[model samples]
Target: MLATPIYIICSPCPQVGKTLIARLVCEFLLLKNGTAASFDVSLKEPSLLDYLPHITETADVIDTYGKMQLMDPLIFHDRVAKVIDLGFHAFDEFFKMCEEIGFMKETVRRYVTPIILFVAGSDRSSWRSYEMLQRQIPPGALVIIHNEFALRGGLPEAMVGEHVIRIPALPAFLKFYVDRLSFSFTGYLRDEKDWSTELHQWIRRNYTMIRDLELRVMGRQSYKPTAPCGRPRWHER
Candidate 1:
């Protein structure tokens, strides 16, 4: 059995599809026979809360109770895979609390596989946040996710040496339907849907990628590295 993962899908920039990636992870975990849930930290209505209402809840990291509500379960509950849809506003406080409380140590101690997926963005702030997280979190616990749908160009060879995952961009036409229609991937995939369409193919490919990732992390699979897509790593001027 694949070990359950705890993913914190985060980015310093808004609208870079952090929730989009989180939703996918949650769905994939459920399909793999692992229970999945999420903590929605976005101030407004994030897509995770909007769609996966049954699997997620609104969370805040500004106080002790909220931190307990968020961190304690992740550390103690080994049965459910959890996703934290971290937003821009709560970035600093969340990591601050984590670092101070030895969050990574506790997760490691409890045998929880913690994966911090920083959604890739182009802005300088995004890169800085990426670098900051690399420093704060335990080394090798960070997995940078390149959201090609909203970013441009390829990554800098120096930013992430290895273990980067890329999400291919959704075609504009498909994006239109997704934005206009209220659909759930888990529901749609289990029900009737064309398996040959671009959207379906895209979803399947992502699921494959995630499965490959899960196996790779647990030493059950291996694959050659592909050049990641997204903005190049930012260098200070």
Candidate 2:
């Protein structure tokens, strides 16, 4: 059986569409597994919680109390897929906690897989953050996200990961319609009326990409996480 998936959608740079990806993944998982939950660690408005309030809860990991509230539930393999929309502000602290508490090993032992869907950017911060995660998390668990809207110049080879998931940019005209909190990707798909529309086609392409990503993660060989030797100086740069 495949391990329960915990999709952590994160980016070290702000306003890079991290929450948009999280909303899509949460909706995708809900459709695929019939049950899914999400956490919004963002301080920005109109985050995952705002977009998918039914299944998303506000999360904070700044302090030990907040960390416990977030990590405790995730440590359990409840069989329900999870998605975390981690804000750029908490990016470093979140992973630091994971390393300190042996989170990767514990998750592996509990039949839970934690995959980091890192949004790729050309910024030095983005590049360095990706490099640091390579040492801290299993390579197989780090998936690069090529968000066309965010990175119009295209993906940098150095920032690429073992696995890549692309999010095609939607035309500005159509993007405005989907940005509304009331809008729903899955709901739009279910409506046969919009099947021939551009928005519908765009959503279909993204859903297909997400579906393929899940299958690949499931079929990939299992990984055993080892203790991180020491923190990388990537942050010092």
Candidate 3:
């Protein structure tokens, strides 16, 4: 029995708060489950390392030479919960690497436990990128988190497709804190306050939706079917 790994893939559109949302979600899950871990595949930036030290210790850096390697699947089985941060600028290269290594589909299916959190925003470009990603990702394997201004109209159900989960705009105060911290630490300004109290309230209101999305992606079983007569069925028939 092993716990599934959660993959947070930040879509193209810049400044969409993908990394921040990923960090907050990881923090929330860690606090709730007490056994979760977070990882960052951005070797160049290593943004999540400062926040979550435990998972960083085991992270594998992907550099320009195109070297991408992941930890053994068995190691992550049931021992830990993982949140992966995919950098915006590195999306194409990272995806190419995943394809080259055959890790995208193979690893996902082998682990039998994985989630793809695609973060998006309200702007036209961001929403467009979301639409594109939705089509590219595997069915029942995508979770959409919409990040918008607190007073904005929020997300539309039709835009993100059926399996989407909208995380409303972040509170003003939390957004300020995140912006300041991101600037001070990484020289990168990322505003992701939608994970604040106000946003959490929204998430709570829609908790069932989130749970259902998780179930669809990570709740898959590794068991195989046997003969109809209740007898052992061999693959080599």
Candidate 4:
């Protein structure tokens, strides 16, 4: 059987669409299965939690108490799939604590898989960050995300991880629609008014990508997560 998935969306840079990816993944899992929990570590702007208020909680890991609030629930609340929209500011601290406490190992031991989606930028630092991240993490635990909005130049060759995911550029005309406070793809799908619209089509495409990526996270095709110290070669479709 596949292990429970804990999706952690993060990046070394800010405004790289990490929250958007997290929201889409959480929504996709909810549709495929039943329930999932999410964390918003955005100290500056917890917009993801605001968008998905129903399933998300705000977590600040700058202090010990804040760390406990986030880490405790993620470890003990094994009842549903977990997702963390990790902020760029808290990136170092979050991963550092995880490493010191063996967060990934402990989760895997409890039958939970840790999936990190590291969003990339066009700068040299992004590539360096990606390489550093790959070294610190197990192979199957990381996926490189290429967000076209920021990195129109595409990801550096060195930034490629075991698996690569692309978040296509959102159409300029539809940007305002999605940025609205009430705009949610999951909520829109539940309403009958969007059946024949372009927004619906865009969401469907996102869903397809999320599902395929999810298969890999769940140990399918080229991506297979094994026991401790063993990580399969995760690849993109």
Candidate 5:
């Protein structure tokens, strides 16, 4: 049997579209593969059960730190794909817990793949966060995803490696809509047309990159993440 793929989607800061992208990826995988599932490790806000009603009924609701004790080893046995959405605030604590329980080391040793999706807009602070995260993530385990917000200042290509995937700036109008109705079904329908087009294009461009990373990790290919460059002296204004 093929081992399940677990995707950990996180960022160095909050509101970087971590959950949004995770949901979209989960939906895409569900459509393609029947056994895929997604879960949220956020200790606050609406729980995963609140959003994904399909699996909430039977799926176990383990706390962020409780997963180590609650989850069965066989849970990783199936062809199922799990996406863990970790809120920024709980990220460090969760990592520590993973270490305490030995899950962290096991995850790195096993087929579990870690991919950091960094989101930054025109805000210089966002870029700073991206750079900080780039430096912190373990080598060969990070993939940068730039979320362009159509702002005046764009990030330079040199800052990122070849594995970086650039998502075109989402229109301001679309962002407004997304912010207004992100968690509602109406949001899904209202934005479906535009989002589908944009998302499809984005996925097409980055699919190979994502797939390659997955293959590389799954096949146990030797890989090393590049060390981040020194911090930018000046923040973009």
Candidate 6:
């Protein structure tokens, strides 16, 4: 059996498709394993819980009770895959609590890998936050996400060789349908007749990338090395 994964989809900047990626990961887990859960730590409207309320619970790290509620299940040895849609507002507090309590050490001991899918932004704050995460989390546990629509410019030279998962830009025609909370990626794959549509291809691309991420995390592949130059070395799914 694959090791249980706790995917924390986070970014210090809003509207960077962090929640969208979280939704995808949650749905992917549900379809792959038939059991999955998610935590919605966002203050934004149309968050992960909005899209997947049945499997998602609202979480907060601002106080002791809330922090325990959120972190306790994470250390469990159950095989259920967990996804956390962490928002910009809760980023600092959530990670601070993690560090304070030796969260990573506990998860490692439990055989539950905690992977941070950090959505990259062009701002300096985002860069600094990424750097801080590098220091706080193990290199293999930290994966950079590049949402094509969210990043206004290329990543800094410093981020060239990081383990990256890229979210492709959704075509204009498919965006309207996907924006609806009622739309489900797994449902579409099961029910859609034509598999050649842009939406189908887009969803498959993301699902493939996520599956590849899982395999790599399972130690089937080695972590990435520095790219030649200029080009960012993204993990090929």
Query: Which lDDT values do the candidates have, in the order given?
Result: 0.74, 0.83, 0.54, 0.76, 0.52, 0.83
lDDT of candidate 2 over 1-237, digit per residue (tens): 467889999999997889889988988888888999888899998888888888888889877778877887786668899899999999999998888788887787777888889998778899889889999988778899988888888677676445788788889877788889899999988975857788888888888988888877766747555564342222222
lDDT string for model 4 (31-103, tens) is 8888889888896554788888999888987877788778766765255889999888888888888877777
| Tens digit per residue, CA lDDT, model 1, 1-237 | 334468888888888878788878888988886578888998856357886888888888877777777776677535688889998889888888877777765554455677888887777887888878878775566788888888768764446675688888898887665553267666667674689877888888888988877766646312333343222111110
Winner by TM-score between candidate 2 and candidate 1: 2
RMSD of each predicted structure:
9.3, 5.4, 8.5, 6.4, 10.3, 9.3
Off by over 4 Å in 4: 77-79, 160-162, 190-197, 220-237
User: Model 2: runs farther than 4 Å from truth?
Assistant: 160-162, 192-194, 221-237
Point out the higher-scoring one by TM-score: 3 or 6.
6
Residue-level error in angstroms, candidate 4, position 205: 2.0
Cα lDDT of model 5 overall? Answer: 0.52
Clashes of 4: 1
- Which order, best to worst by TM-score? 2, 6, 4, 1, 3, 5
TM-score of each candidate?
0.84, 0.90, 0.65, 0.84, 0.61, 0.90
**Local accuracy of candidate 5 as per-residue lDDT tens digits, 8-38:** 6665466556655565556555645755666
What lDDT is obtained when candidate 2 is compared to the true structure? 0.83
Cand. 6 TM to true fold: 0.90
Ranking of all predicted structures according to lDDT, beginning with the best and ending with the worst: 2, 6, 4, 1, 3, 5
| Backbone Cα, N, C clashes tallied per candidate | 1, 0, 4, 1, 2, 0
Winner on lDDT between 4 and 5 is: 4
Per the 3 Å backbone cut-off, how many clashing residue pairs does candidate 1 have? Answer: 1
Clashing residue pairs, backbone N/CA/C < 3 A, model 3: 3-77, 3-78, 170-193, 170-194
